[model samples]
Target: MMTFWYIFVMAGVTYLIRMIPFSFFTKRIKSVMLRSFLYYIPYAVLAAMTIPAIFYSTGHFLTALGGTIVALVLAYFRLPLIVVALAASGSAFLLSFFV
Candidate 1:
């Protein structure tokens, strides 16, 4: 069927797209900036993923906002990542339960 062919072609294209980057990069030399960027990319990605969730959970702005501030401070103080996450999530949960 046409659908089967379409799926096959799409799968091939997706695999090639995913593989090409590894193939290209594995053969190349790395630069200092690239190393630094790679090191910070996870933090940047974590912030990008978490920040919006902190501000907009359950349609309640203030509770989430307050928790976010607390989490930021905990993180700034160099608390463990798990502790920071737990503090933020626990604060948000308590606030939601009470307010």
Candidate 2:
């Protein structure tokens, strides 16, 4: 159907948009500020993506939010990423079960 074609075209455009930046900058740039920004992009993106989820989790939002705060503190103390994730997820799960 026409909708399928539309989705395919949109997906292709999105892929190109994401790929073009990396392809264009692979060898021509070497700025320290740019590198630092790139290094933090994932964290910035993760926060942007996850913050809303914490606030919007409906029945268990508060517990999840608390867990996220604890995980953040652990991360600040240099805990491993996996441990932070597990702790946060476990907290959220336990709280959801209780509440």
Candidate 3:
């Protein structure tokens, strides 16, 4: 069926995109700028994806805002990531009850 072909093509494309960098980039990157850019790409991508969702993921804006603040404070103190995530969600859950 057409749907099967579409999915097959998509999977192949996705696999190749992920595989090409590993096959070609066997040497260590020598450019400091390029290495720095690569190092921060994941964080930048995560922030871009997460920040907008943070504001809109809850029923009320204040609850989400409370969670964001909790997350920021936890991150500032360099707490474990799981602790920060759970505390943020807990703050949002508790705030939602009162909002």
Candidate 4:
């Protein structure tokens, strides 16, 4: 019962955190600086969350590093997201066999 209540509360809090932005920010943001900052926040947060996990994700740090480099290169070249993800995991998978 306690766990169920906690989950319900958390779900509501998460919903409001995401909902408030779309409900309120109906118009395009007028500030160039603020808009640019907002555009980059997702990427920054993604890096913050994923980078540490990348180092410890596999048996070898080098394998994960190789995969990250492959993913970054593909992303820089503007490849599709699916291709980048597949190539990254494939690179890691192949390299793991060797190491």
Candidate 5:
């Protein structure tokens, strides 16, 4: 079936992606710029993947924006995770009623 071939190709690609970096980058990277870039890659990737989901999660833009703002403020203040989450959800729910 086509699905089987697709799966096989996907697995091979995934394996090659993982294998290439390990096989090719065996030596220590001496470039400071490259190291810094690599260090921030995870955070950059996380934001890239997460920001769109956050904005689109709620059906309404205002509700999602309200929730995101609350979350950001609470997170900036270093509030507990549960508190931030609940407050964001509550704010979004309240905004949904208004907007």
Candidate 6:
């Protein structure tokens, strides 16, 4: 089936992405700027991926905004992850009734 081929191709691509860096970058990277860039790449990628999901998860923009605001405030206060997550979800759930 086409689905099987798609999965096979995706798996190969993913493997190549991980393998290529390991295969070619066997020596220690000496450039300070390159090392710093590599260090921040994951966080940059994570924010890019997570920010949109946060705003769109509630289906309604207002509700999502309400939740995101609560989450950001809680996170800024250095609250526990569980507390932040629950407060965000609770805010979104409560906002859903009004929006």
Pitting candidate 4 against candidate 6, the one with the higher TM-score is: 4
lDDT of 3 by residue, 1-72 (tens): 999999999999999999999798899989999999999999999999998888887878899999999999
Alpha carbon lDDT of each predicted model? 0.85, 0.82, 0.94, 0.92, 0.93, 0.94
Superposed model 5: Cα runs more than 4 Å off: 22-24, 51-53, 80-94
List TM-score per model, in order. Answer: 0.59, 0.68, 0.80, 0.77, 0.66, 0.75
Better of 3 and 4 by lDDT: 3
- lDDT for each residue of candidate 4 in 1-99, tens digit (9 for 90 to 100): 999999999999999999999799899889999999999999999999997898778768989999999999999999999999999989999999888
In terms of TM-score, the best-performing candidate is 3
List the candidate 6 regions with Cα displacement exceeding 4 Å. 22-26
Poorly placed runs, candidate 4 (over 4 Å): none
Model 3 lDDT, full chain set: 0.94
Whose TM-score is higher: candidate 3's or candidate 6's? 3
lDDT of 5 by residue, 1-99 (tens): 999999999999999999999899889889999999999999999899878899888889889999999999999999999999999889999999898
Encode model 6's per-residue lDDT on 48-98: one tens digit a residue. 988888788988999999999999999999999999999999999999999
- Lowest lDDT 10-mer window, candidate 4? 51-60
- The order of the candidates by TM-score, greatest first, is 3, 4, 6, 2, 5, 1
Q: How much lDDT does candidate 2 score?
A: 0.82
Off by over 4 Å in 1: 1-19, 28-44
lDDT of 1 by residue, 1-99 (tens): 999999999999999999988778775447888889888999999889977775887468977887888888998999999999889888888888777
Question: What TM value does model 3 have?
Answer: 0.80
lDDT of 5: 0.93
In candidate 2, how many Å is residue 26 off? 3.3
